[model samples]
Target: MIITRAKEYCIKILSSSNCKKLPFHNLSHTQEVVEHAALIAKETSIDSEETEPIIIAAWFHDTGHSKTYFGHEEVSKELANEYLTSVGYDTKKIKIVLSCIDATKMPQHPSNLHAKVLCDADLFHIGTELFFCKKLLLRREWELEKIKTYSDKEWHKINLAFLEKHKFKTDYGQTVLEDMKLKNLEKVKTILSFY
Candidate 1:
C-alpha cells in the first residue's frame, strides 16, 4: 500500500511542475529504483517494518533533479520531508526516508539498513543490461550541464577506475549483485581495450 501510494505520488510529481530540468532523473528512474528496493527487501533478510521508508526514499530520491540546482541530494531530502509531511506520512518514517535519500550522496557510506538499501537500489542497474544506458544518461546529463565531455576511451577508463575501487558493503549487495557487477566491469574493460 505504501509503495503503491508513493509510486503514484512520484508519477504525479514528475508529470506536473517538475518536468523541465530533469532529463534523466525523471519518473521512470524513480519507479525503477523503487522496484529495485522492493526486490532487494524481499530477496534479503531486511525487515518489512522498514520497507515503507525505503520505498518512500526511493520515490523522492531524485526529486531535486527537477531543480536548476545541481548535486541536489540535500534538496531531495528537503522535498521528501515536505511532501511526506504534507501528505501526513508518519513523522518518524519521514525522517528515515530523508536520511535514506541523503545517504546517496557521492561520497556515500550508508550507516544503517535503510541507507544501505537505498544506496544499493539506486545503483541496482550497475550489473544489469541497462548499465550502459544508465551511464549514457549520466554522460548526457553532464553534457547538458556543459561539463567536460568524455570520449569513449576516457569514459571507459573512468568507469573501470570506479569499478576497481568500488565494493558492495552490504551482505545483500555482495551476495546478489557483485558477480554481475564484476562481469559488467570486465565487459567495460574489454570495450576500452578495443578502443
Candidate 2:
C-alpha cells in the first residue's frame, strides 16, 4: 500500500542525521500521531480509503523537522509530494495528504474530515497523560534552539493560554479528549497559581 510505503519512507527520513536535533518531533512523536490517527479514524468510522491519506499525512507531518523547525509544515508538504510522486501514489491522494499535512500547521484549520482527523492526531498528546512530559521535551527543544527561555511559571502561563485557545475539531477529539485537555489546562493553571 502507498500508506505503508509512506510510513517506511517517513521512518527513514526521520532517522537520518538531519533529524538528530529534533528532541520533541522525533520518530516516537510521528508514531504517536499515526496511532492517534488510526484510533480517531476507527472511532469516526472513516473508511480505509479515506484513512490512507490521514495515516500518510500523520507520518509525514513532522518529517520536515528533519530539515528545519520554522515553517516545517510547508517543508513537510513538499517532501510528502516528492515522496508520494516518486512512489507512484495517486496524484489525487497525494493532494489529500498534502492538505492534511497543511492542516497540522499551528492554529490548525482543517477544511475536510481527513484533515480534521490529522489535526487532532497530530496534537493528541495535549490531552494524554504524557502531556507534561512531552511538553518538557518541547521546552528543552526551544531552549536548545535558543528560541526564548521561559521560567517554569512563564511556561505555565504560556501553556495555559495555548490550552485555553486550542479546540479539538473532530467529534471524537471533543468527546474523548476534550475533558482531559481541560484537566491538563487546569493543571497548568494550578501550577501557575502556586508559582
Candidate 3:
C-alpha cells in the first residue's frame, strides 16, 4: 500500500536523523501516527479512496521535524511531494496531502474532510492508555527545546487545563473515542493530586 511505502520512507528518515536534536520525534511516533491514522480511517466511514492520502499524509507529516527550522509541516509536504512524485503519486493528490499535514498544526480546526480525518488521527493518542506518557514526553521535549519548563505543580495544572479545554470535533471521535479521552484525562487528574 502507498501508506506502507510512505511509512517505510519515514522510518528511513527517522533512522538517519541524529537522536540528540530529534529525540522525541522518532520512528515510534511515526508508527503510532500511522496506526492511529488507519484506525481513524476505519472508524470514520471515510471512503477507501481517502485512506491512502490520509495515511501518506500521516507518514510524511513529521519527516521534516529534525530540520534546522522548528515548524516542519511545510517541509514535510515538500518531502512527500519529492518522494511521492518520483513514485507516480499524482500531483493533485499532493494538494490533499499538503492539506492533511497542515491540519495537524497547533490550534487545529479542520475545515475539510481530509483535514478532519488527519486532525482526528493526530489527536487519536488522547484516547489511548499512553496518552499521559506521550504528554510527559511532550513536556520533556519542550524542556529540551528551552521553550518552557514547569514545576510539578505547574505542570499538573497546565495538563489538566489543556485536557479540559479539548473537545472532540467529529462524531466518530465523540462516540468511540470520547470515553477513553475522559478516562485518560481523569488519570492525569488523579496524578495531579500527588503533586
Candidate 4:
C-alpha cells in the first residue's frame, strides 16, 4: 500500500541523512513513535483510512530534525507535503497527516483522535520504563545542540514540573500511560531528594 511506500521513502530519507547531530530524534526515535502510533491506533480500533494518515504522520513527524533543530515541524510538513503530493496522496488526507505532525509540537494541542494518537505516541517514552534513559539522551542532545544545560538537580526539578504539567490526551494514554507517568514523576521526585 501507499503507506508502505511512504515508510520506505521516509526510511530512505532518514537513512541517507547525516544524523550524528540528532542524538535523540533520529531513526531509532522515529521508529519507536511509528510503532507506538500503530499500536495506539490499533488499540483504538481506528479503521485503515484513519490508520493510514496516522502512520504516515508518524513516519514523517520528526523528519524535519534532519533539516533543523528547532521548528522542525514546519519543515516536516513541507517534506510530507512534497512527498505526499508526488505520490498523488489525497489532499485532504495529506492535510490530516500534516496536522498530526503539527500536533506533536510541545504543549501539544491535538484536536482530533489521529492527532491525539500521534502526540501520545511521540511522547510514549515519558510513560515507559525507560523515561530516565530517554531523558538522559534528550538532555545530552540538548546540551550538544546548545539548547540548554542543566545539572542533574536542576534537570530533575524541571522534569518534575514538566511531568506535573503534562497530560496524556488519548483515553488509552490516560488509562494505560498515566499511572506509569505518575510513577515516573514520583521517581523523579525521589531522585531529586538526594540533590
Candidate 5:
C-alpha cells in the first residue's frame, strides 16, 4: 500500500546520515504518530480514503527533522510532495497529505477533518501514560541541539502551562483524550508543588 511505502521511505530516510541526531523526532515518534492517527481515524469513523492522507502525513511530518530542526514542517511538506509525486500518489491525496503535515506545525490550526485528526495524533502523547517519557526525550533532544534547558521543576511548570493552553480538535480527542490530559496536567502540578 502507499502508506506502507511512505512509512518505509520515512524509516529509510531517518536511518540515513541526514537524521543522526533526532532523539525526539525519530522513527519511533513517527510510528507513534502513525498508530495514533490510525486510532483517531478509526474512532472518528473517517473513511479509508481519508485515512490514507492522514497516515501518509504522519509518516512524513517529521522527515524534515532529518535535515534541520528549524522550519522542518515546510521541509517536510517539500519532501512529502517530492516523494508522493515520485511514487505516483494521486495529486489530490498529496495535497491532503500536505495539509495534514502543515496542520502539525506549532500552534496548530487545522482547516479540515484530516488535518484535525493528524493534529490530534501528533500531540496524542500529552494524554497518555507515556507523556513524561516522551517529553524527557524531547527535552534531551533540545539540550543536545543547544536549543534550551530546563530543570525538572521548570519542566513541570512548562508542561502544565502547555497543557492548559492546548486542546484537542477532534471529537474522539476531546471525549477520549481530554480527561487523560487534564489528569496529566494535575500530575504535573502535583510534581511542581513538591518542588
Candidate 6:
C-alpha cells in the first residue's frame, strides 16, 4: 500500500509541483524507471522485501529535479524521507530507498542488489529503442538549463564517450540490455558520419 501511495505521491508532486523546468526528468521518466526497476528486480529474483524499496526509490529518484538542477539526489532523498517518515515507514526501508536514490546519480556506485537494480532502471532507456527520443529530450533539457550547449556533432561525440564508459552494473543489464546498447552505439556512430 505504501508503494501505491509512493507512486501517487510522485505523480502528484511531479505534476502539480514546480517541475516545469524538468523536461526530461519529469513524471514520464520516473514512471518508466519504476517499471524497469520492477522488471529488473523480478528478473534478478530478489526477495519481495528488497523489491519494495527499490520500486519506491525509483518513484522518488528523480523527484529532486523538481527542486534543483544539480544535487537533485539529495533533494529527492529529502522528499522521500519526508513522505515516508510521515507515513511511518520503517527506518531501515527508508534508508534503503535513500541509498537507492543516491545510487541513481551519475557514475553510479551501487553497493548492493537493490542499488544496482535502481541504477540500471534509471538508465534503462540508453539500451532501449527509446534512447534516441529520450536523448533528444535530455539534450533539449540541458540546453534549456544552459548547462552546456552542444552542436549536433558535439552531442553525438559526448554520447559516444558516455556510452563507451557506461557499463551496466547488473548482470541482467550487462547481458540483456547490452545488445541493444551496442546497436545504439552503432546507430550513433552512423548518425555522426553525416556531420
Please give the RMSD to the true structure for each candidate, in Å. Answer: 2.0, 1.0, 2.3, 1.0, 1.2, 1.2
**Per-residue lDDT tens digits of candidate 6, residues 12-111?**
8889765655678888888889999999999999888889999999999988877788999999999999999999999999999999999888889998
Local accuracy of candidate 1 as per-residue lDDT tens digits, 1-195: 766776686677677745445566777777788888888877766788878899889988887776644677887788777777888888989888988888888767787888888888888888677788888887777777787698989988988888788776567778878988899899998998787
C-alpha lDDT of residue 194 in model 5: 90
For residues 1-195, write the lDDT of model 4, one tens digit per residue: 988899998887777774445778888888999999999999889987889999999999988877887999998999999999998999999989999999999989998999999999999999989999999999999999899999889999989999999999998899999999999999999998897
Candidate 5: regions farther than 4 A off: 18-20
If ranked by lDDT, best first, what sequence of candidates would result?
6, 4, 5, 2, 1, 3
Candidate 6 clash pair list: none
Better of 3 and 6 by TM-score: 6
Compute the lDDT for candidate 6: 0.91
TM-score winner between 2 and 5, please give it.
2
Clashes of 4: 0
- What is residue 192's positional error in candidate 1, in angstroms? 2.2
Candidate 5 residue lDDT tens string, 74-154 = 999999999999989999999999999999988998999999999999999998888988899989998998898998888
- What lDDT score goes with residue 168 in model 1? 68
What is the overall TM-score of model 5 with all chains considered together?
0.96
Instruction: Name the candidate, 4 or 6, with the larger TM-score value.
Output: 4
List the pairs of residues colliding in candidate 4: none
Per-residue lDDT value at 7 in model 2? 88
> What range of 10 consecutive residues in model 1 has the weakest lDDT sum?
15-24
**Which residue pairs in model 2 clash with each other?**
none
Regions more than 4 Å wrong, model 1: 1-3, 17-23
lDDT of 4: 0.91
Which residue pairs clash in candidate 5?
Answer: none
lDDT of 3 at 97: 88
